[model samples]
Target: MSSNSTPYYFVPGLSRHPVMASIGLLGFGSGMTGLVNGYSWGAPLTIASVVYVLFVLYKWFGDAISESNSGQNSINVDVSYRWSMSWFIFSEIMFFAAFFSALFYARSISMPWLGDIESKLLWPTFTAVWPNDGPAGLVEQFSTMGPWPIPTINTLLLLSSGVTVTWAHHAIRENNQKHAVWGLAATVFLGAIFLGFQVYEYIHAYRDLNLKLTSGVYGSTFFMLTGFHGFHVFLGALMLAVVLRRAIRGDFTADNHFAFEGASWYWHFVDVVWLGLYVVIYWM
Candidate 1:
């Protein structure tokens, strides 16, 4: 196939990646189930599966990188990749939507319905207010997190990182490699700082505020939302770090930098999600 012209299609040969990824996922799922059931080998098994999956990812992406760097990728391939990444991000949006929907349902509908006159007749003392300690007070008292200090700090950090990443994109487009490198490094640094603040907030929530996952619906929603977002932040930081490494190695250029673009898109999506969380979960 001509490198300059779009080929009919760039069909890859059969590979073991799909089966291997499935095996790894299965093992990981089994390990998690076992660990939840208190099995001794569960932790080790989970670690093994995770390592396997990471290794597979490394090899798989390495091959794709080699293809791209070797000029095997055409405009068609680039377009396909862009579409795939867009769809992937859309799927991620739906994933977060489900969680956000659950949060809304719990707060707006379920809580009030449970606290209403008829339902409260069964449990007379159940408070309708949010962050309550449940009907029987089985859940321990805990303070809810406010959109202050650490969370606000994280919001700022993410916003700044967005700006930095955008600057990096612009620099790359302008063929200013040095500025691109600096911008990427700053973005990664900001992401790391955001994660640090999140970790500190979690520690404070558990220790000082008595907010555990079991602390009632409020705590459950709080941790579920924030914890998943934390994971996404870490993943986005890792993605940016990879892009930064590639930038330092002169991988991306003005004409071809979809990998960097994809990472930036993911990072921006992460930032937007956090903004939603801050307003809904923190402020609201």
Candidate 2:
């Protein structure tokens, strides 16, 4: 540990991580309150909240980076820290898996049963349709989305982004800095374009097809799954953008590029989730 740092290898001071985090959450909650309340200040409230949260995250991660690069963090500490982060990411995956599983079961088993002998009497007028069947309780009509155009394009975009990130990883390993930077730049651009197209799709859904969060059971699960996955995509893209900036400054070496790898894995996970969503939500 450094003379300025503590025995546990952390910065020797009363950390503001907790207090700052609380403020960020409070800002977010207040902003959500305004949004749900549908007030004039709702947009501002949410904007402030997002800014606060981003600022807090910046400071939190910034501190950790300083702690690591300042020689206070040992190799032993780094290994242990990596294990902890791995398990944490695993837990996050499990959390999302539960949601995805519920979505699967609801669409496959529950919806089918509702239109069958188990609840046929209850839903006397409802037909056993694949797309519109919401749940056993609320039998509403909703058009199912096909994997013909928008979804297929999105899937391809994510797949290509994954390939580009992998290329960047390879370039870094080979010490081809220019190629790696180009790859990162391309990945980030593709990610941005993917988001833009997804937004266009959402608008098309609301306008032409009348698909939305309140349309039916299909709409609910579809938005939840795809929306969350999109948020992850935003995060992955942001991370990749930052990595590109770092690469421009020669901040990372081939042997110590865990930051780049982490971003790649995260983007791949987002891609995988989108694939599952495409099959279950759009295809079946």
Candidate 3:
């Protein structure tokens, strides 16, 4: 085993996976502690910490890329990488599923039973309602996000981005490198704009509609489902950006384009999830 040409193409010496995971876990723990304790600066500090950590991660992965492209990732290493990525994506699916399940349980079980006309002796004031307004009843008697304005716009943006990614995929398969790069760039830009509008919508909800996270069960579930979906959208956009960067360098060809395909697949997944949210959370 006369190895030493590249750092990651072959097995490097013992690595620091544990230390890195611990750093992330510690940051999360402290942030959550402050949040639960009602510290004023908790949210801002947590966000800053995450941005710093992301910067560290970018530089670290860049170094690994330098090694792998230099012939470090051999056949065996590639196999392991594929398996790791598969499991990681599977884990993400489970994460999103939990939120969806929460939504289903709330709408189907809790609201119906609580509002049942039969429950006169129970929750007399409660009525089996589609939009429960707020659990604590703090919100100023409002309507849902609705399918017309912000939500519909976001849905179109996500759906169009999905189509663009598919176009980019086909272009790569046909060796139309320029189209692939430009299509991916457009998809990434749309995702960022969608995120921007979503943030603006949140501000409107908080200030104008009196719809904060603490409003009640309605607010809680609404934000939990949509907020998590928004975070996924942000992540998918970043993935597309990475794919576009590689495309610009002429790195992917038809048959050897799993990297781009994987990102595209994830973006499509996000779009599908958003469609569900738009219908359930917004319209009905």
Candidate 4:
């Protein structure tokens, strides 16, 4: 392609980013394994690996952004990005589906089976309750998490963020930079607040309610679902923040704004996952 003409497809040159990223991940995995096995250098290795990963991501993303800004990304590239994101979100759905299925099995299948007459004969005092501490009473006594102030508030916050992110997408399409920035900012703010409330909820669960990870099936499922969701929210918010920065810098135009759209898609996916969690984990 000529310097003045857009390429049919932008194929980046072979780079060291993939190798560096793999090394960083390997180090992180090794560090985590060491930490679990009580190795002395685990903490330092983990921290260093995290820093290395972040640095590599920074450089890698910067290069991609530069390519986009230079008009190297064609329409074909945009379509590929959309399809890639769609498949990525579909995989995330499956990830959560596995967790939800575990919850279902524990609640609807295994519990009832254990409560049956045949199983009950083995342990006369055991009751197969939803939040039971196991037949042997191995888990600690704990209260269940309810859909109250914090959880309900978080649900509302995520729902509202969905709206705000959609509004930002509309604003971007209309070439209204100011409104887009504001909308993205509001979405990020709401996500941050939701995370803050989640932290408080976890603290309350541990300190007051005594609902911990060791509280048997209920506690483990609840924490696994909500904790993973919270992590996704953090990532979604971070992506929105980056998109917001780009918006403020007037990077996107009415014709081209896939970065903004991609971030919004992820944020919306996070919102949808939270809704499912609220219904299944909290209400059910």
List where candidate 4 sits over 4 angstroms from the true fold.
1-7, 27-48
Could you give me the TM-score of model 2 versus the true structure?
Answer: 0.85
Cα error of candidate 1 at position 284, Å:
1.1
Deviation (Å) of 142 in candidate 4: 0.5
Give the Å shift of residue 171 in candidate 3.
Answer: 2.4
- Candidate 2 stretches greater than 4 Å from native: 1-14, 29-43, 133-142
Tens digits of per-residue lDDT for model 1, 216-237: 8888788888888998998888
Candidate 4 lDDT over 189-208, as tens digits, reads 99999999999999999999
lDDT score at residue 99, model 2, on the 0-100 scale: 78
Q: For residues 1-284, what per-residue lDDT tens digits would candidate 3 score against the true structure?
A: 32232244476666564467468657866875687579976776677667766666666656655655455555566667677767877887788788778878877998877766676565576666766763345456754565668888988999899889988989999999999998999899999989998998898888787776666667777888888788888878887887788789876767556668777878888888888888778877
Q: Each candidate's lDDT (Cα)?
A: 0.89, 0.77, 0.76, 0.89
TM-score of each: 0.93, 0.85, 0.85, 0.92
Q: Write candidate 2's Cα lDDT for 1-284 as tens digits.
A: 34322345333478887798788788777876777577888779778877887888778777766665565665455556667767866876886798788777876787778788867676677666656644444544445667878889988998999889999999999888999999999999989988988898788877777787777667777777787778778988998998898788776666666667777777887888788888877877
Error of 2 at 104 (Å): 2.0
Which pairs in model 4 have colliding backbones? none
Taking all chains together, the TM-score of candidate 4 against the true structure is: 0.92
